[model samples]
Target chain A: MSDAKLLRDELRKKYLEFGLEAMSDEEVVRLVLSLSCNEFDSFTEKLIEGFGSLKSIEDADPQALVRYSDIGERSAVLFRMVSEISRCLAVKNVKKGVYLRTTADAKSFFAPLFTDHREERLAVVCLSSRLKAVAPASVIAEGAAASVRASCRRITALALDLKADGVIIAHSHPSGKAVPSSGDCASTELLASALSRFGIALIDHIIVAADDCVSLRETDIPLSFRDRECFGYKITKLL
Target chain B: MGKGSIHSGHRDRMRSRFLTLGSGGFSEHEILELLLFYSIPRANTNETAHALIERFGSLENVLAAAPEELMTIKGIKSESAFVIRLMHDLCKRYSATSDVSADLSDDEKLEGFLTEYFSENHGNVCLLLDMTPRGELRSTKCLPTSSLLSGELGSREIAELVVRNGFVRVVIGQCIDGDKCIPDASCYSLTRLFAETLAPLGTELHDHIICCSGKCFSMRKNGSFSFGSGGNHE
Candidate 1:
């Protein structure tokens, strides 16, 4: 076999045995590029030099990737596909029937739904009396880049429809701060009161911004419920 | 009080408790007794439930018991056995539906899922995870395996399945009966054979996980095998 073929074979062997973590950024890029390009060694080197790192290469748009002399549409598409797959795999959904009792649980469950959203969005997690998620988190509202409104009437109606004993409200802020706005705090109190009149508890309100999330109940916000003693059976903490 | 009135009063209270407090309010025997109310009818199942727990050691084992094994106990007829089996199948169905959209690309998440997937079964089985190009799980298939080298699941058959399903990426999991998570030489050979067979078809074998007795060993993570173009072993 030729020298290029020998090197490619060696890399494939290493990947199959030791997996992706064992490979360097250049080696991984080379292996992926080799699948599409004939003279992949030079193509891999050129792309790496332009992008600077494996993460940057994965994040690079197809248009930017195709600017390289050796990288064609097929290679560009492959690179983008790999990047998209990695992202999808990374942000897993909170499965149904999982308990959402703590702020940490609420964060993990809500964070994935808000990933990569430029526009603000609001979601409600309907919980059973036992604090287990009764259904998948529902995206109730979507608005412009900076602000989204939560409809108290609509949220109350949804809780009743699902027969949920409690609900956790979450919304995304594209501005990259997990702090709740004054409007956020005001609306959460109103939402809590509306839910409480019907015997439903507004367990918590979470604000997600970029990678960070903050639970409003954990904050100094003075949001109070009419019947905090109702769903006091299974909820141990963060009630 | 007579037996009939006493049984009726107890049943009414149990039903009321379940409705008000859910499964968390009930003990193991109480849960089983509540379940048996539908199948057995009228008679107090509290004793039967206790007998089942004593025989099988736990509610999980009692539910997992074979129909014949369940019928070995007094008052557990075919109807009771059928209900018990149905409950077990229902739990499996619920778990499967809940986990339908699970992303199995992360090693730790994948291991946890595989371990739970194989928890009930003591037999050797091979699980195939058909994933989309975007790494989302499309479907999962579990096939019983006597051995890896057995003709039950050859590399050609796996390749055909991948091609038929149009799966761009896949994960193969082998669940052994015992607690040894280590994969022998046959496992390595099978991985290479699978990788080679699928590579030509543009389908990538993402990883081969070995799950044994609640523990999981990831071949891709540990790494020592090769799927070279030629027969050049490293």
Candidate 2:
């Protein structure tokens, strides 16, 4: 067998024999570098531990990952590639009408495709009549402030064009602090106000930062009440 | 010249005279006159402040305009303008750097960055930056929020960006309130609606922020309850 295959086989044996749970950090590092695919057990576990969990690792910054002793630029890049692939797959599945049940479930859907990125991103989650996510589209860079007008116009236009029933807005903070910014609060109100006039529903806004993601609805801000809508306006009850 | 004269009034008068003289490239003495505006309340800063304003324009404009704009005036030749410009650019770029990535999936970072940017603006001007999946910066556009009653954010505006530029992700940011406050239900609802519409196109809804004067709030922080759709992302 080739050296890579042989090395992978050897590591797999070690992983099974010692049980991956008991491996040392050094051993995990050595094994990660030797594996054919960087998605080895030790590498993933190391990434998870460093980031606190798979969801966090997926949301971590690439440069932060590179800072790890065993994770060089190459490994960091590879891991990011693997993570991005997973994010794409998750969005793809959701777009295919997959029902998302929990935040963990959402993380799993995106873990393969998005991880360790330096730039910010914005996406629109399109839903059908049943509230199932049917598709997601990137709304492009919203700048340092995640303002509503620009994002809302883009998503609203897209929703109108697609004749979608509803939409969700989600994005990540590379700073790894998922606490909502004031801008986040304002845009949420603006977008919701704008879409209310169109008969389309705005369901939620999600923030994905390092190791933690927060949903606006979970906060004390009254969300479900029509009388409490933003811009001093109420949206058409389309949910 | 009487014994009951203001002890330090002479300094104030001299400073104002210097300010007037400094209007044509104010000397050090003339510039010091304007610095007295805040320090010496009754002090006459007419000559100095006028000179400074002549050299730099109105104080409001001087502070509001870009440092590059400030440097265009005479007698302000120190690296201060460059420093000021650098500081402003750094702030913009720092926020921009927060979302720096070549991969398209990392676009959420960009969205987060912009949300904070726009949430701080009180005006109507909106800033939009487009990118490809390869992390290349694309075209930047400005749109008025009030005028966008009919304009929708469709893929056509970003078609070349996504296809030719290889941008798998995109983010949009702007500021409006100049005071970050909790978003209303409509905000959360609109974001969710957008996510649902864009799902088929393979794009993800990252975030929406309301930027106020000095603060920002992420809808996701409070919008999670409304999202309800839970699944593995990675």
Candidate 1 lDDT over residue span A70-144, tens digit each: 476555544444333333323323457898867778876876666534458888889998889997787677664
DockQ of 1: 0.01
Predicted candidate 1 versus true structure: per-residue lDDT over B1-234, tens digit per residue: 888888778876776554333333456687788767656767989899999999998676887899899999999998788656645643433343234446665788888877876674334556667653334454454443433356545666666555644555667777765557899777777677678788888766778889887898888778754433222122
Clashes of 2: 174
Which pairs of residues collide in model 1?
A17-B223
Q: Provide the lowest-lDDT 10-residue window in model 1 chain B.
A: B225-234
TM-scores, all candidates, are: 0.37, 0.30
Question: Candidate 2 at residue A227, lDDT?
Answer: 35
Q: What local lDDT score does residue A169 receive in model 1, on the 0 to 100 scale?
A: 85
DockQ of predictions, in order shown: 0.01, 0.01
Docking class of 1: incorrect
Cα-lDDT of candidate 2: 0.46
Stretches > 4 Å off in candidate 1 = A1-61, A69-82, A85-92, A143-150, A210-212, A226-239, B1-234
DockQ of predicted candidate 2? 0.01
Clashes of 1: 1
lDDT of 2 by residue, B1-234 (tens): 753245246544543343222122333333334333323344454554455567655442343466566556544443435323322322332233233223333436555455544443234433434443333333333333332222343334333223332223434343444344555554444455444544454553344555555455555555543332223132
